[model samples]
Every structure is written in structure tokens, then in C-alpha cells.
Target: MKKLNVTEIQEKPEGFVASVKEELNVELARTLKAGNRMLVDSDGLAFIYIIEDELDYYYVSFGKGTWPSLKKLLANQGSLDLELGNSLNIELTAIADELAFLTENIEGNSNYGEEMEKAVSDIFL
Candidate 1:
């Protein structure tokens, strides 16, 4: 959650490493302990923070550039697939289910039901 300025990042280049060390308190044996180069795709329109641990590679997104790239990639495959929409719908459904369960649990249980209802309504709205 630490917001680093671009100049600070550019000056150190290892700013993320330092941030990680300070935040996570991990002492790396060597600088190479940090794996994979940070990449900014096209003028900082999109950036990726990649880390590799053993045979596993993980990427964390800090911005919204991937969506257009993903859409383009999907389109190139020659279909207007609803996969993304479906995934979002599934997640929303899960949230709705959880809200319903919480509502049932709060029924006839003092002010809990009102609070739960308000929270669920706010999220849905």
C-alpha cells in the first residue's frame, strides 16, 4: 500500500526490493534473490510485477492495461467469447449467495439482520 513516486522508483530501480524488504522483512542473501525484471509495457500504459520462486512464476497487476491486451488476444482467437462475463457473473453470484446466507443467519437475531441487509444492499447497489 506504500505509494512510491516514479522518480524514486527510477533512481533506485530496486525500490520495490527495498519496499518488499521493509514491508515483508525478508533479508535476501543476494540481489539476485529477486527474480524477473519489472516490465512496463509501452510508456507505462501497463506494468507488470513478476516474481519467480523455484519453478513457479507469479505476476501481480498494479494497473488496468492487461484487460485490453486480454481482449485483443481473445479476439484474435476469432470468437466473441463470454468467458470473462461469465467469470464475473459467477463471482457476483457467489457474493449474492454469501449475502443470502448471512441474511438467513441474522434473521430474528436482534439488529444484526438490519446491518447485514444494509451491507448487502450497499454492495449490490
Candidate 2:
């Protein structure tokens, strides 16, 4: 599977979450329109979590898929209850290996890393 380099959002937690949603929505639309099946390993989710990890932008607390899942919290408002539990534990693992290529490929060439970062960052801001 190919990897996606998502830009690291250097802003407040809310900013990061909003940015992820916006990026994901756009990418999802584009991917679907292109007739590409969006597997868990697709670039869209990878772009989301990798940026989340790099930013450490979790509002309550930063975890693996905290950013994307938190962004999803609003849509799943009923899921989260008076007490946070399993509902809050959104799985970001599925798409993680997708981004491994971005991190791993840096070993061979520095320019590739720079370009990848730029591509991810340009997804939004």
C-alpha cells in the first residue's frame, strides 16, 4: 500500500480536529469520485492519524487516533455518555501502517521526507 504524508497541524487542539475533518472529507470525496476503494489502509486515514501523532493535538488527551476520533465525536454525540468509556476509544490502528511508508522512507532520502511533509501540510493549512 502507498503511504500518505499528512501535514502536522500546529495549532490549538480544536483547530487540529477541525482541520482533520475538513481534510478527510475532501480526500474522501476525491477518492470516491476517482472510483478508488477506500480501504482502511488508504491514504485518507493515514493522512489523518500521522498528522495527529505529529501534532499531539488531542484535546482531552493525545492518543493514537485521538484527533480523528475526537473529530468524529460530534457526529457520534449519542455514543459518548455521562461517562467516557468504550465509545471514546476510537480505533486509529487500522490505518496506521498506511503512513509507515512516510516515516520509513525518510531513511533513504531527506528530500522525500521534506516533500512528503509539504504535501500533507498543503492538504489544508
Candidate 3:
């Protein structure tokens, strides 16, 4: 795997795009820490790789029933009816979701062309 620094990911994420499993899987795993974010995929698996950390990352898999709530909680960065753990976990969750969004949209092709403006219609009301 091509280990990438945060900057490299930010500048050119497309370079890392590949098969979902190959893109999300890591060789080594680590414990989640404060300020650590997750790299998530459509499969509901989340990976963690902090700065200067190994290419492999600590990961957690969520079930279908709960994954959506967790994903939403992280994306919104707000408190929800769901309960997981301490403030640190909540914070980390939020960051993880953000990272997942970035990876999913850029590397996963979840939002391609969504930002582009639509063509004008000649038959406007």
C-alpha cells in the first residue's frame, strides 16, 4: 500500500482510489487516541491512522442498524439519542465521519458531479 501523509491525501486523494477492500484495508492497527480520525468505507468499517502513524490503522465495524446513526452523529458533530462513550469518543467520532466523507466523496466517487451547476432550461415557467 502507498502510505500517504495528511497533506498528500488533502492535495490529491484520487491517487489512492482503488477497489473498496484494498482501499480500506490496512496491515497494522493501532489504538484510537485523542484527535485521531477514522477512514471509513461503505462497508461500515472504520480505520484510524494518526499523523506519523503506520499505514495500518485501528478499526471498528458497525452493524447496519446502528451504522447510520453513528455516521450521522459524526457528520453533524452534534449530540444524538445514541450513546457510545466519553466526550473524547464523540469528538473522535465526529472527526472520523468527516474524514470518511472526504474519502468517500473524493476517493469513493460518492459525490461526483453533484457540485456542478445544471444546464439552463429553455422552457422555464
TM-score of each: 0.22, 0.22, 0.31
TM-score of 2: 0.22
lDDT of 2 at 56: 31
Summarize candidate 1's per-residue lDDT along 1-125 as a digit string, tens digits.
22211111111221111111122112211111223344433333333344434444433332332233333322333211111121210011122233234434444544444543344234322
1 or 3, which is superior by lDDT?
A: 3
Over the full model, what C-alpha lDDT does candidate 1 score relative to the true structure?
A: 0.28
Candidate 3: global Cα-lDDT? 0.30
Question: Judged by lDDT, which candidate is best?
Answer: 3
Steric clash pairs (candidate 3) = none
lDDT of 2 by residue, 28-86 (tens): 22222111112222232233332233223322122224334433442333222111122
Give per-model CA RMSD: 17.0, 14.1, 14.0
Of 1 and 3, the candidate ahead on TM-score is 3
> Model 3 TM-score?
0.31
The CA lDDT of each predicted structure is 0.28, 0.30, 0.30
**After best superposition, candidate 2 residue 98: deviation in angstroms?**
1.9
Worst 10 residues of 2 by lDDT: 32-41
Rank the models by TM-score, top first.
3, 2, 1
